[model samples]
Target chain A: MRLIAIFFGLIFLLVGFRNNQSIELIFPSSWPEPIYNDDNYPLNEQKVELGRALFFDPQLSSDNTISCASCHSPYNAFTHVDHQLSHGINDRIGTRNSPAIFNLAWQKDLMWDGAIHHVDAQALAPINHPDEMGSSINEIVQKLNKDVRYKKAFKSIYSDDLITGERVLKLLGQFMISLVSCDSKYDRVMSGKDKFDEQEKRGYELFCKNCSECHKEPLFSDYSFRNNGLEPDPQLKDIGRMKITQNRMDSLKFKVPSLRNIEFTFPYMHDGRYKKLTEVIDHYDRKIHFSNTLDPILEKGIHFTTNEKVDLVAFLLTLTDKNFMFAPEHGYPKDFFDQK
Target chain B: MIRSIQILILFFSLGVRAQDSIPVKVMYDRFEIQPGKTILFQDDSIRIDVVKFYLTNVVVGGSELSSGLLFDLEKDQNYLLIPISQIDEIQFTLGVDSLTNSNGISGGILDPIHGMYWSWQSGYINFKLEGIHFENGIAEEFNFHIGGFLNGYNCERRIQLQGSSNVSRLELDLYQMLQTLSTDQLKKIMSPGKRAMDLADILADSFFLR
Candidate 1:
């Protein structure tokens, strides 16, 4: 109870800074510090509102077909829950899954391959991918320049100016990084306010022994590249990190993902192959695919009984953060664009 | 004394070791641009601005060049730096460092109308030249976007002077380049592969920091 009060008190301090556009969440006291230093791009509600509008707006696309929300739906933890692969404009299918986007401020790299080196530049991949938004920054800028509201948004933060690509990318990155989801049920247990049940306790112990090295504690990812024994797809054939550097040794290696709220962000992996966590564990136990670049953690798969799988699933379920998922402040900013 | 060696040498190796903060300024020497060619102005075609270059470790020769560049502290300023005794004083290529193209966007430097950006692609334009060309008495307009970020053909480079002086600028005579490279070669280079290499090599050979 004291921990929860302290958490809310810190949240209040952040909110006191909110009117100045600085309401960053204080992750549980135990979690490691975030990689995102908000000092460079301080939180501004006006910019975030503008960024959210741009995020949900189709005007960013070349042909008015898809926004970022097209593939990564907010209701599904910002991931496309049904489709195995991401679909973009013209209903064109992409090669990989639209990974859930939150807790990004802690991420050192982005994209399945870490191809887009900078967070500011990540939007360009989806915006310009032929199968995705299919838009050019020049063409997009010309459109935004004409919109009266966008011009107003641009003027409010930046001085009298034309809407440039840089402003759009930077503002959008600010909003994305602000989507931190650190207050889950698992977080409460870790803070010691509440204890896990017997099943959850057993599962937590098993997970610590089996998965904590790669999917480490607190943030649940080591942020290093590893190959988890999945074979390359014949068609998609994504080289993961290797594609970015063109290094043969990095073949099949991928960034280990955070397990925070993993229950909601399903059909997992770089390709969205397993629709359920059971299949993922099953692959680990019996269906371990062979590859030279496989992560040593899965070299000899761990066999779990059905009860163990159930317990593991129970442990993963504790990661859901209803506070972050439905926070009113993060919802669509009705004040800014509520149609006066 | 041991700690002092670590601190002084650490800061000193960058040639920019804070020698009372030398102030350098770039001004257009003015050259006419013509057909059949392009000029590089930034590190990538995606985020274009020749004025804002990141000065990383600065060193002038052989082993010094490698160690210096590999360890630059990265100063955020505009304009390229050419070491003295590296090249002829009359030429320069107009774009970003080769490694910068592949490094992709990391900072707050991607403004579009500055005319040197391609946010969708992972690189910046090394050179951007657009004008009409004339080939075999035929008039033709040309646009060249020469930049290779992922591929080894990356073309952003800085030239050093033949004498002892630290300076680099391309006072473009766009007219001279048009007159030099026939308009036919101008229209051929577009999406930053081999053709970009040839044109960028030409611009690199031409530049010297005077």
Candidate 2:
């Protein structure tokens, strides 16, 4: 009987150690459960730390100059703000603006064109894009395997030093899924921790009347592809979602971006056409180009007074989570690099 | 203690016998109509630089052999191991199924890192056959990437080889597939669409049991 007790105690300790390795995702009660299934890629501290290192490492690129953080910088809410279109290796400019990365746990599809369906598969696009990172996952894996720092990190975390492309992508996914931005003033108000100001309150009401149908609440996005009536750029001639579905109706349609961090994540739209929120409001109010594929809600076009526009912009500001934008954990893993 | 030792010996003997019965090899042959170093297609000398594809759901004797296997002409994994038993017929898919393509990230042959998947699209390129054809002493490149899983665009082909042999050889005749297309029409096809589906059908018909 005593022997059995000792054996059971050892088993319990082993289980406890394994459990402690994994971390749980936390969010407000009002928010829906994340779309990314944690069972497929469980959240563990070691994996997340490794992912953060890879995220900021320029070695993932062919020239070893561009990193995931180059376009998706955390300071700018994980988006490049200096330019309209994203710049890649050899100063090659990509066709579309780099979309902000946040609240990705709820995103079913990624990219402006909704080309990638899964977040786990998303990093491969930029990595292999000739105009982007200009590197292959195979090449990245070979490089990672040679590094003494990575070998030690892999062994300590995965208990094996074998570095494969799948492990690299999955670890990156773990870090990306950990980027949950739900601590905004809007989230605070929803949780009964704070109240919206008068200007912000009016803007919220106006937003519900005009934009909430597509850019929904709490998460600020329904994660659907829609044609927002932007005229096609003659040079790019990008067909947006139609390139994926091959349907004429999906032409000019793009994924609805979250209004969270709208103040910082600009210039706006897939092409970064509008430089200011006022310009976006003006486009929606009167500059909307009529098209067959345009979203029915924006068919008549929104009518916003100058004063109303200010209020709406004020409300959009409340969605910015300062805590998330400056979180130390999401920044560059300085200690990991210093140790290396 | 005596009984347990006897049982262990019995298990060890059974394992050795199982290993001894397992077949050593299953060969795959890549041919171009005629057996030679250079393949003549439509009077043009063609050299196949690469031929990569996936074989999934290999069923033998009503049991699954393995989930999938990637066959690359450049690699040395052309042969496979089969259990030494009656294999009534070998059934396998020429491409990955729709379920596997939609199941997010996968490992091994199904991993996106293999470059089999389209970076912009969500589906894998089921078959990739690249070669250079010398037309008037100038080398012309031809690439055919066949893959599609969506409705009305599914390019997966199911093949059944009917025979029982210690070494089964599957032949991929590139010349036969090229006969379906005119030389002028043969260019590049890297994305999945109508042309990819059409070529996928032609490629599927090019396979035969030898």
Candidate 3:
């Protein structure tokens, strides 16, 4: 085993010498360590660029219409805002809303129900969903293998043009792991770079007191599944975590999404029932339908006056990192695709 | 230093050592299964288009042969050269375990591109048997994509078989698996659940050392 390790080590160094496009994860030092480790899955600039191109390419779908960016647009923190529930190819509607994608390196589980445990494997869900992309990794790889551009890109990175499901999925994972959103107003305030105004200050206190338990600070989420007291939609009848676990206690429990970029990633919640951030606050304030699996912290129903509600919204708005949403590198790779 | 040398020696002498290994040939019954060929079974005839299964943690003579070996009877040769002299007892899991499922995507036979993986959910289809099952002069298609790694629903079964030194084959009776299925299970099984678990048990039970 040691001999093999040394042999592989020599090959790794030789490969590393050939490729000088390796990148590093850049985020606030004060933030907790991201769950994604670079030991097994290293970050590379070329691979990330390849992943970004795949992210925006519609060829990934069965009919070559819907891409990952169709629902997860970079402008809306990688989430669609036009529809409450996400729609896909042939105008077919999915059951749940498309959640925002940022700071995913810290996320332990993907999707509202925490079904996908790995970031690399998360793309399979929508890609294979009949209502969504309606495509398989096998089908996508066959198409990608035929494309000269994909062949060239893969050859440049892997030193060969062999495109497989593992490479495609891992490349997508590389791009997702690269998405780090820490430069919010709240982050600046915490770092002593900026100060909150009177209204914002009061709202921050309320958030810390009431919301911080589940939507924990720093990352803005503890990444635990919880029934935050949204009454189950009669039509959807989506039994969130229970579908995965098959346990009665996990019924109606969905993953607590990060509130970062909360201003843009609306229609909120698992089913996207709440449209505005104000409506989301109002749900907690008044409309929390108690159930057996409802989050115990929200059982008592925190009462915030209209004035306090406005202040809370003010603080929530500060969580938006405009730089992340509008990052030129994160946008559609027009130049990459426009090339002959 | 000693361990490193031992490993280097073991690696270099693998080809020489493999001569002593036992060759285990897989069979449908008394005959080898040919893809796309109609075969007689009890009172009916069935044509197997695809028969794929994962034989994981293949242990022969207390030595593990492979971590996971995906067997595609249509695509692969119907034999395994297990790296052991004589098999007193052989033990292996009939499906990919929960640990591999939780670890996510991997390369080689475990890759999701093999079509053994479920895209909507995160798991591998341990045993995939798709064929036309003929019953009472009626032809019907059957697709049993059995797999689940979740608690209470995990379909992987640890199977052990005892054999003498002369035993050169392991036979799996597809007819036995067909007998275990109910009318509802004869059509299709796409997802993991109680039904998949039941089918996995039947698939595991179908194998015997000869």
Show the colliding residue pairs in model 2: none
Question: Against the true structure, whose DockQ is highest?
Answer: 2
lDDT for each residue of candidate 3 in A85-198, tens digit (9 for 90 to 100): 999999999999999998888887789998887888989999999999999999999999999999999988886899999999999988988988888999999999999999
**Tens-digit lDDT track of model 3 for B65-172:** 754567787664545557665668988888888887877787778878898888767788898888887888888888889998875799889999998977867667
Candidate order by decreasing TM-score = 2, 3, 1
| TM-score, predicted candidate 3 vs. hidden true structure | 0.87
Best by TM-score: 2
* C-alpha DockQ of every model: 0.19, 0.47, 0.44
Kindly report, for each predicted structure in the order presented, the TM-score of its chain A compared with the true chain A.
Answer: 0.90, 0.95, 0.95
Q: How well is candidate 1 docked (DockQ)?
A: 0.19
Q: Per-residue lDDT tens digits of candidate 1, residues B33-60? A: 2222334322211111222222333443
Poorest 10 consecutive residues of model 3 chain B by lDDT?
B17-26
Q: Model 2 reproduces what portion of true contacts? A: 0.55
Models 1 onward score TM values of 0.70, 0.91, 0.87
Interface RMSD of 1: 10.5
How far is B75's C-alpha from truth in model 2 (Å)? 2.1
DockQ value for model 3: 0.44
